[model samples]
Target: MRVPTLQTSRQTLDAISTRQAEQARLQNRIASGLRVQSPGDDPAAAAQAELARSRLAHIAQDQRATQLAASVLTTADGALAQGTDLLQAARETLVAAGNGGYNLVDRQALALQLRNTREQLLKLANSGDGAGGYVFGGQGSPVAPLTGTMTPTYDPAAGTQRVGENADYEATVDGEAVFMNIPQGNGVFATSSAPANTGTGWIGAGSVVDAARLTGHDYAVTIGGTAAAPTYTVTDTTAGTAVASNVTFSDGAVIEIDGQRVQIHGKPAPGDSFGLAPAGRQSVFATLDQAIALLEGNPTNAAYNQGLERVHASLDRALDGVVLARAHVGEALRGVDAGSASNQQETLSVTTRRSGLEDLDLAEAISQLQNSQVATEAALRTYASTARKSLFDLLG
Candidate 1:
């Protein structure tokens, strides 16, 4: 009987201790405001919370990357905008120089202004991002890509940065594309009348009306016959040798040779030659230098007119390059904004999911904690009463 009594007491003590532990756990949950403190409490919910947290961390990292990309693109865009304005100023100067009334003094003044403009462009080309790297530097060259006023040198390689998951962006504009790579005229061929031509002969802007027929070679139209029966012949001077010989010429004649159509106007004197060559790449810096030289050279009226036309063509191409760079920058900015929006939405969803898995309901938790406290107190009181009542007391 005594053994059974002792066993019952021991069972009552174990019950009280278990109830006390339950009460303490409830209190901890209420204080911490987390229902699932460990995976042991709710394995599935804990795993879900961990996954959400991991996704949120990734989102944060990508958001930072997007912000960095946006900053670089913004800087590049601003630089390109300033470059456009500088080109416009150069164009305006060229126009002023083109005026018939402008004399040597006026031309010199314009050249000085152009020199200043070129300096500004160079500065823009070598702009930095306030960091160790250059804004326009393609791959972080050891030195500036464009230097020297008379003959600038550009040597750069392409470089890119990351903005999002599997999304890499070009933050640096291709300086070579902007400064050195420009198709001369019509992206095919360029035409120019000889400066020594005394006749009223003029070469209109030639076009690559046909690509297949074009030999991609330079040609010259030389006048040989008398003025009464003036004859023009097309010669491919690719290797100082004539490919097409003795082609007939007439006033206002449209001649198609090597896939290009060129219109000839006015008369051509003996030995007068008009040139045609494949449109090739030329640097904007070199173009500016050449323009300055032409303005200072004080060539004859006809020569000056021809030089002005060439300058206009080069300026147009450079402007196009600047516009293209700006467009690319705009696209990058839009992408960053879209990515930012996506990241925000993802962060919201993750936070909501994690909250669902881990957040506690204060009202429900408080009610359960109170109930557990009552049970714990009841168990303790019963155990105390049972312990006090010994065998002798029970028998009496």
Candidate 2:
């Protein structure tokens, strides 16, 4: 078959142009150190590289989240440590106050020390995590977990209120556990009780009762019996008469039978009596408060000494709560560390895969560029020499 002369020249020029374009592309890849600069260069490789890069980005984001979570938990743990110390100091102060020999002046001095401890505890409770939010307040931003005076009133109950996410991450601490779990005074009674009026000479009655002597055994007490303003009366079964003795009231009021003063509450009636015994919830704070009052020369009355014992018991419970909180913080810190490590590993893996798919091998790329350049040069030379030679020239 005879070749077309015109087509031959055109074909040579087209071949040279294609070779030059390829050489330029290869050179660019070598300079940039990228095998797949565009999807046109290697469609399958480009797709794989994109997927790997996306996975790496996600891993990085996860690592950041883990870091922030760890920071917040660490702040909380530090605050709890301070709280534990304050609680311990308060326990010791209460023990000192329970000593019977301390006079009114000595007791008042002890109350001042207790008040200082309470202030420190409040500061700890209100501690913040670098970010303007309280550590113990959970997800409730900007609100302190505990504040103001602690009081007891059944109707107007008060205590730490939870206001945050219930997820394990948010529930890293329990505010109520830290502030309200004191021995004998954890109930609504402690929260809602009215303050003692000094002028009225009445001190607040804590739920706990002090140990005292009883005149009648296996007897009953009735308050406000038979009269319009009837009240409690103690009856002696052996004597078959009203003893009117050895009964005490929670408010430091006493009654007299023979020469001995007995505690009584309200108005007394015939055959109405209550068994004398120690009573109160086991609480750490209540015990401390009682000790403070006793040290301040405030009458703990019959219930004061019993309150000191409860304070000691409450301390153990509070310490346990603090330990649990610390453990939770430690666990969260571990989890954060683990998550960060996982994210770093995942990121490294994704980056490696991405580099394999998208990065150019410099040695191979340089060889390809040289080969393409030689092909382009050879095509240009061939096209220039052959296109200029006509059929007549060939015959000559």
Candidate 3:
């Protein structure tokens, strides 16, 4: 009889303890608002929730990436804008330098102004990301990739920073393309007057008339007749061959050679020559620097005019490069915005999925908790009443 009583008591106590544990679990679920606290709670649901959480984390990371890219790109865009304005100011100074009414002193003042512009432009080119990194630092850049000297130097990286590997979403513009890799002279070739010439002739910026006919070789134009009836000859200095000889020289005449066309203005003395060569990369800084040097030498009226024209063409191209860069940055900002929107949407979807997997229903949990509490109280009362009863009374 005693052994049977001990077994009965142990069984009742186990039942009561189980009910209490269940009530406590319900209370915890209500307070914490999560149904699956551990994998053991609901293994499948917990696993799925973990996956959703991981996806959400990735979405968050992507959002951060796009945000960072937008910031860097905005900085680059603003710098390029300022750069454009500085280049415009420099162009205006070049125009002023060309003024015949402006004496050497006046042009020198313009040169000083141009020097400041060049410095400002250089500063813009090397603009930072506000975190000790270059905003225009393509793939990689040193602390200061571009030198700050009057003759700025740099070998800009090839590719820009980006938010994704295959994405066209660039975080920064290619500094090389914007500031260094600009076409010199015309897009095809450059022209220059011979330094030793005693003529008042100026070489205009040439253009490509026939791409197929261009030899991509250097050529020299030599004037060889009396001033009254001047004649010209074209020699391929690169190939040491005469392309044209004894061509009639006319003032402000177009001299087309091997597919390149340039105009000559003003009188030319015999032996006055001009040079033409394939276009190469001319940095905006170099262009400005050369323009600054234009007035340093007491050049002839013709030489000053020639230098002025060349500088103007380069400045035009420089301005175009900056505008194009700014446009590119704008496109990148739009891309970032699109990416950000997509990321936010994904985050919302994932959050919903994760919540469904692990989140508790407050109303259901509260009702379950109340029922559990009642059941636990009844179990304790029953166990206490049974414990007080004697074995002999139960047997009777």
Candidate 4:
């Protein structure tokens, strides 16, 4: 075979260029501390590195979510703790009021304290969870979980005041389990009966029951025993005429004057009357309304005292709600921690796998670089020697 002189020189130069390029690339990798600087260098390695980087980013994002969740839970826990203290204080006031030595004046003083404690509790219930939402309001935003005004009515036949929970977080806990599981009040007022009325004639009526009083009325009203023959005595005070007749109440039941509502189970006072359906969902306020009425009225009465006892029991029930809520918070915290740990582990594993697929072996890279350096040097030396010896020297 005839060898072309120019072709030999061209091939030597090409080989030297390729070796020098490889050496330069290895030096760049070392300087940058990264295996794959460009896709052109190693397309497969670059793709693998991108995948690892994406996984790391997701892991970091999940960690932030976990931290945020922890903060929310901590805030919720603190609010619940404050609520528990307020409830305890309210119970102490109730017990003090129960003491025989407390006169009506003393009872009135106790009522003031009760009102203060209740206000504190309302603040706690409406506490923000540090995330622009009420901790107790489930998913609702920017509104308090518990809210309403309270008014005093001198109705004798009412029940004691009690606090109840409303809007509970349902995402991590059962709403009913946390807010609707309050214990039944004393047997004095059957869950199905209208509370006994006080001997004092109805003091007066209002245009609108205050929000709190109305809420209490909602829980206080109940259906009593089997319906009796309905009847009505209409004394026309203005007309000065007494008329007696049988007034048929629905379901053969007459409304009793229990002071809560004018439902079929009970009749409103001369001036009092039932209004439209409740403004909001039934809640602790409703329960408390019934309880406060029961407590203030003749405490000496058995039914009244029974209602009071029930109110105390309700305190325990409310506490149970807090405990249940805390349990859910705890569970959520555990889940968040577990998820963060899982993400961390996965990130580490992916990083290792990606390193294996994309990262250069420093020893191998260093050795290859040295070899390329040597080959380029050899090529340079050969080129210089061949260029010096011309075609005449070759022929000789």
Candidate 5:
């Protein structure tokens, strides 16, 4: 139905106002490079964009956390590397001191060198991250982990800090796991031939087959009987209990006891004996102390050989422990790097999606702005013309 004269002017004015408002909205979009000026523009898209933004923020936070974890691991890795070097040097010194040509004075000189190395190892053990936190601090502690002027003491507990998302490289390497509680004696079990053995029997390095069944015990393998009817017995020296008795001994036999297994690889005469002890953890500080003690002790004493053996064993385990620790650090670093790459990809994907929903398309926005301007001008001209015609008609 056609409107009355007064209503016609009002309708024209409303149409013009609507055109002007649309033109202003388009212009704003074009100038600001944004599609949604307010939630009303596209409520669903606006909500999606907000979620995308929150995801981006979370990604940024995860990136920062990953970086911090990497830094801490890097520091620990460097210190462990240094520790390995020091252990190697000490090993070389021990080997040199073992030479028959070396005199007491020479041994004493080596001792002094090892004392300095001990101090250096201590420093590495008690290393700080310069953030008022220690690299080996388990959980966290204000005091140093290793303290004391001579024979630095170790704190059994240390912190294990993890980084990253819920899955993948998020669990970080722990300090105590690396440096403090490393297994001694081949990192599994201690194997040795009897000190009183007159035969050429030997025991090879053994491994724990069943982790659950492994009972840390001191076991002695005593060989008796004739070569034809060789017999062996397993006795727990620590508990003073017998494990097995009168088992036939073979040239190469795999002995299993208390969930631990070992192989004897050489010929053994009657009265020969072999032993196995549970592997325990030791600190790098203790290894250095033993080395120093060997040099200070009487070289010709009856227990001199045993002491030397102990020191060599300790040093070897220390070196192995550091190497293992470094391996873990490297692994953690790789995890962080991988996590970083993943985060970057996710950020890119979210940003792209957000841009599609909220960012203006420059070409389309400009085109629409131009069309709106044209339409607004046309509406204004039509309104003015109709208003003038209505006045002329009324006058006539």
Candidate 6:
């Protein structure tokens, strides 16, 4: 393909041009530390390297999301821990109110202490993440999730905000379940005494004796017969049927019916009645409110004992709920940590693949670059020498 007019010179020039281009390409690769500069260099390796890079980008994005979720969950855990402490303080105050030596002034003071605890707990329930959003705000809320100073209603959406749209973990714990749906009794069933009864009797917070026989129905235990020969009867109040009748009773005897059992203490009047109902959700606010009311009432010793027992049981359950929510947050935190580790592992693997596909082999690249430089210099020298020979020998 040489031109007839200057075939020898043109051929020499073309040889130098090609050698120089190859030398320049090798130099750029060595300097850039990338062997595959373009698809033209190695199409298959280029495509695989691009895929690896895309995966790395996604992994980075996921890691960022995991970090954000961990932060929110950590905030939620701290808020719940503080709430548990507040509830513990309230329990102590409640116990103090039950003291017989404490007179009206003392009980009132104790009630005020409980009121303060309620206020503080309400604030904690509406805790924020320092980003103008609530830790207990559930999915989202324009206002505080738990409102109403007196009752403290849970008004937020039911679902918790998650780390991601499809993430199995929650960034925030379920505040409604923690604060508004606390179990009232021993986490199974609750018991109560009839207000009209004038007896020294008290009912214990009962547990399910047999799961297979659980009726999940309310029952009424009534004292019957003469005062000297008192007997107790169990009736299924929910189903309107007798569960047990004419059962012998003594002081603090355990009574069982429908797979549930409770011990009654003290002497119950012949007509005195006690009620047992399946455990139901009671708002933490209402539980505190009840304690405040009990102290504020300055009731008789008998009433104080029974009412305080109920409040104590309720508050304990409230505390348990908060602790449980805290545990859940801890679980989510662990999950986030696990996710971060997974992301790091994937990032490393992808980076290695991309390095294999496109990263320069420094020693080998340097060697190739040196060879190309030699080749380019040799071609240039040869072209100059040939040009000199052809001009001198042109006369020949």
The digit string of per-residue lDDT tens for model 3 on 64-124 reads: 7887888899898889889988988888888777778988888888889988898788888
Order of models, best lDDT first: 3, 6, 1, 5, 2, 4
Q: Which sections of candidate 3 miss by over 4 Å?
A: 1-13, 155-158, 163-172, 210-213, 235-245, 377-396
Compared with the true structure, what per-residue lDDT tens digits does model 6 show for residues 349-371? 99999999999999987888788
Ranking by TM-score: 6, 3, 1, 5, 2, 4
Which wins on TM-score, candidate 1 or candidate 3? 3
CA deviation > 4 Å runs, candidate 1 = 1-4, 43-48, 193-205, 208-215, 236-267, 390-396
> How many clashing pairs per prediction, in order?
3, 38, 0, 21, 4, 0
Candidate 2 Cα deviation (angstroms), residue 211 = 26
Q: What's the true lDDT of residue 224 in model 3?
A: 90
Q: List the lowest-lDDT window of 10 residues for candidate 6.
A: 1-10
- Write down the lDDT that model 5 would get: 0.76
> Residue 316 of model 4: what lDDT?
52
Q: Which structure is stronger by lDDT: 2 or 3?
A: 3
| Candidate 2: 10-residue stretch with minimal lDDT | 191-200
User: How much does candidate 6 score in TM-score?
Assistant: 0.92
Backbone clash pairs for candidate 6 read none
Per-residue alpha-carbon lDDT of candidate 4 for residues 1-396, written as tens digits (9 for 90 to 100): 223488888988888888888888899887766687788878988887888888788677666666666666677677767766777777787777667676767767776676676666656656665666555554443455444556211111111111112112122222233443454432112232223542211211112323334322232222222234333433323334443233443431433322222223233222221222222322344455555665555653434444455566555556666676777667766766677677778878988988876677888788888888888898899888876785567787
Q: Give the TM-score of each candidate.
A: 0.85, 0.65, 0.86, 0.64, 0.77, 0.92
Per-residue lDDT value at 55 in model 2: 76
Candidate 2 Cα lDDT to native: 0.57
Candidate 4 lDDT score relative to the true structure: 0.53
Worst 10 residues of 4 by lDDT: 155-164
